[model samples]
Target: MKTMRIWFGCSMGLAVSMIFGWSYGFFAALLPMFVLVQADRWSTPLHVQLVLEIVWVTVQVSLLVGFFQPYPLLMTTAVAIMMLFKCVAMQHKSTYLFGFTGLLIGSILLNFASYNFFDIEEFSINLWMCGLATAPITALAYFLFPEPECATPQPVTVNNEVTKDEYGMVRQAAMGWTVAMIAYLVFNLVI
Candidate 1:
């Protein structure tokens, strides 16, 4: 029920971003859409969802990065990494954090390699911008779907009452998002 509204908001944001030439915005929105679709009670099977997610993401990336002379192998690897991270992130606790960390490491390696191998300055900047955009988009999505524990309070009382584990995790993730955004900004300024 509530998921639909979140998905719509994400979709609309992505559309607006694309229209305004912010490719990263479109990719950022996909995170929420994938989350919303995964949360759907009547959602399609896992295989179907994976197929659609991959196809749509691939299409989006191809269109967004089409202007650049992307290296085929690197592009493939990047998309593969994104798909894997998205799949894992759609699951239970700590998945997003782990998946994103992996994606970031892979991207840093790839982008650094691209810069050295191809002498392209824009790839690093684009990667940083992607991180900046992803931080907010992910934080917003987490705020909307949130973990069940954080989103609801248990009636059971423990010294009055203690919130669920999801609350702690979600709060930590929210805080991390701010750090990530700040780090991205600082790095962008420095680099």
Candidate 2:
């Protein structure tokens, strides 16, 4: 049931994005949707999350391959950002208010930052449109799925060490953002 909802959200989002010339939006929207469905839970298993991310990214790349310049970095980086926003949205619950706030604030800040850093055009409709749908999709998925489980981990201290989980959610999230950013910078530099 939960899995079905996630797929439904992704399918809906992908359909919308394709119509609007933002195929990446589908993947971006999924982050929040997935998180929203699992929000009540403390954490999801890393492997399961990774599989979803890979599948989403693959679909996104395949869909947009015909139109956009074949820039793996750009596509992957965008996916990373979508995933991050989804994580944040999930942590905050699937409230439309939060989603709206993130869309507005994030869009403004991201556009402004791009203008300053990349010196690119301001307020890209495609980018902002993606942001607009990101939160709603997440909320919708959350509403559709049953409340997530509240898993409790063992007590931890400075003395306790942690092991890497699959999907390397934390690590990949960080690496994705970093690599994407670096790739963007390099692209800008070369172009």
Candidate 3:
């Protein structure tokens, strides 16, 4: 059942993207599919997902306009600040805040490197459309296929100290930053 939901969500995303246009269909599909999967795993609320998507778009635009064009130093500083915020947010167990934002940043950086930073309007349109499409699909999937009951409730632990999970989040942030840095360097070198 879970697998089916995942498949359906991905398919819906792809279909919507294809309807929008073939050139960016795959990339458009990826964001929705990723959000759907993560929402399932984390049990994130719809409102939260919506907010995250908005933030993701805002960040993408900021990077493209404010930093990616004429200010390398500002871009570097912005990336660093974002990475630090992601790490801290994760350590505080704010997964939803960091998860989508981190992914958005990394994806944008990597894609920018590969495709150059032209066509910002097209990219933004695709991303916003995909994000809007995700909401309905995600809501439908959750409503139609609710999570199954578990046999036993897992024990919950509260610890002030950093745990393995927190460490993993930090590592993820670091890796994302590293990838962004490499992408920026390659982009500069190539262009």
Candidate 4:
């Protein structure tokens, strides 16, 4: 059942993307897959997923117009700081969301640079539209196939010197930083 839901959502997203065009469809398909997987693990609400998508689109636009071109160094520094902050603040819960956002922003910036900077406005609009399109598809998937409840939350056990939870936190932070750096590097290389 779970696997079916994943396939259904991914196929729908991919179909929608193909209708829009190749470039847009790729992300349209990809974002829903990411969201569905996260939703399954965390049991994140549809509203929260939608909110995150909005935030992702907003951050992408802001980075492209306000900071990416004019102050590339400043933009990269700010993204690194923000990613680190989210890592520390949200810990395990935010790992996927923050990391994915960083990658998305980086890719968007890279695309803009590779094409024409003047198209930033249009690109931002298309991204927002993609997010809007993805939201409903993901929401429907979650609605159709809900997550199973755990009887009780499991406590993290100690491993080596650190608790499993602490180890996870560190891993999340490292992942966040790595994504941020890769995105930054991509942006820098393009522009």
Candidate 5:
């Protein structure tokens, strides 16, 4: 059942995205497969949650870009500071998903906003559309392949090593962001 849902949602989403050639349409593929795997039930508010997440990130990126577009130095600094905050917040115990989504979408949009022709409004609308596209696909995936009834529900484990987990996540997030920023700088220099 899980396999069917993943395969159907991902493949169908990829197909639809490719066919329509939407700028931010990859969300259609990613969200459905991701939510399909993460959701325990079909009727969860996955679609709404995803939209809100995307919208929040979009607003963040748009405002930063809009305010700093004329000054490249300020733009870079603002983007770096925001990314650092997102990276650190993403590793925190309580706000992982929200920060992670912001980091993912904000990084991409920020990079694109470097170009003058980039359209924030269009991207935001298309992003919402891509999110909306997930609802029906997820519903279909759930309807077609419902979770099997298991006699025993698996036990959920709580991690007691809060400091260890948070430290490791912070270290990893910093390393990742550092490497990404350096690479972006080097690539820009080369290009």
Candidate 6:
């Protein structure tokens, strides 16, 4: 049942994205899949919140890139700090929404800014559209593949709890941030 929901949600998102010819449509696909798999309950307000999260991270990256364009050292330092915070927050599961948005979506926007692409605004708009569409795709998935009533429902997110896996979580976050840094370097060097 979970697998079916994921497949249906992702396929629907991808189909809509493809139909619209959105270059950043993979975002649309990915968000719905994640929501379907992770969240037991999703609401209309969640969609709005997700969109706002994307926009907020977009603004943060844009500001960082805009102000620090001339100073590689300053830009890198600031971004690195921000990403480190995001990584830690994500690992801690404290403010998962912000951490997830800031780490993943923010990094994408930062990469785009680094590339100095002429059509970046277009791409950002496409990304925003994808975010907006994610809620519906997830909602539709729920409608089409409702969970069996016999199964206990999980909350949307787990409360932050102390676990023995701190080292593993930190390692994962470090790995993620390292990849983001490498991608940033490649974009800067390539452009």
Q: Which number leads on lDDT? A: 6
Error of 6 at 131 (Å): 0.8
Residue 113 deviation, candidate 1, in Å? 6.0
Steric clash pairs (candidate 4):
17-25
* Ranking of all predicted structures according to TM-score, beginning with the best and ending with the worst: 6, 5, 3, 4, 2, 1
Best by TM-score: 6
Q: List model 1 lDDT by residue over 1-191, tens digit each.
A: 45644665476557656765653454446444544444433233432433343344434443424543256555554445454544346334434433453344333433333333442234334334443444355445555655454456657755854445776656655554444444433443454
TM-score of each: 0.32, 0.36, 0.68, 0.65, 0.78, 0.81
lDDT of 1: 0.45
RMSD of each: 15.0, 12.7, 4.4, 5.3, 3.2, 4.0
Q: How far in Å is the alpha carbon of 80 misplaced in model 2?
A: 17
Name the candidate, 4 or 5, with the larger TM-score value: 5
TM-score head-to-head 1 vs 5, winner: 5
Give per-residue CA lDDT, model 2, range 61-179, as digits (tens). Answer: 33433333356566546634654564344233233233333333333333333333442122234444554565566556556765555598656668664654645655654664465
Better of 3 and 4 by TM-score: 3
* Collision pairs in model 1: none
Cα error, residue 115 of model 2, in Å, equals 14
Give me the runs in candidate 1 sitting further than 4 Å from their true place: 23-25, 31-92, 104-121, 134-154, 157-191
Position 98, candidate 6: lDDT: 58
Worst lDDT run of 10 residues, candidate 4, spans 41-50
Clashes of each: 0, 2, 0, 1, 0, 0
- Model 4's lDDT to the true fold? 0.62
The Cα RMSD of model 2 versus the native structure comes to 12.7
Candidate 6's TM-score reads 0.81
Candidate 3 per-residue lDDT, tens place, 56-157, comes to 755554555555456766665655565555445544444654555554544464346345445655655655566566667666667777778789997888
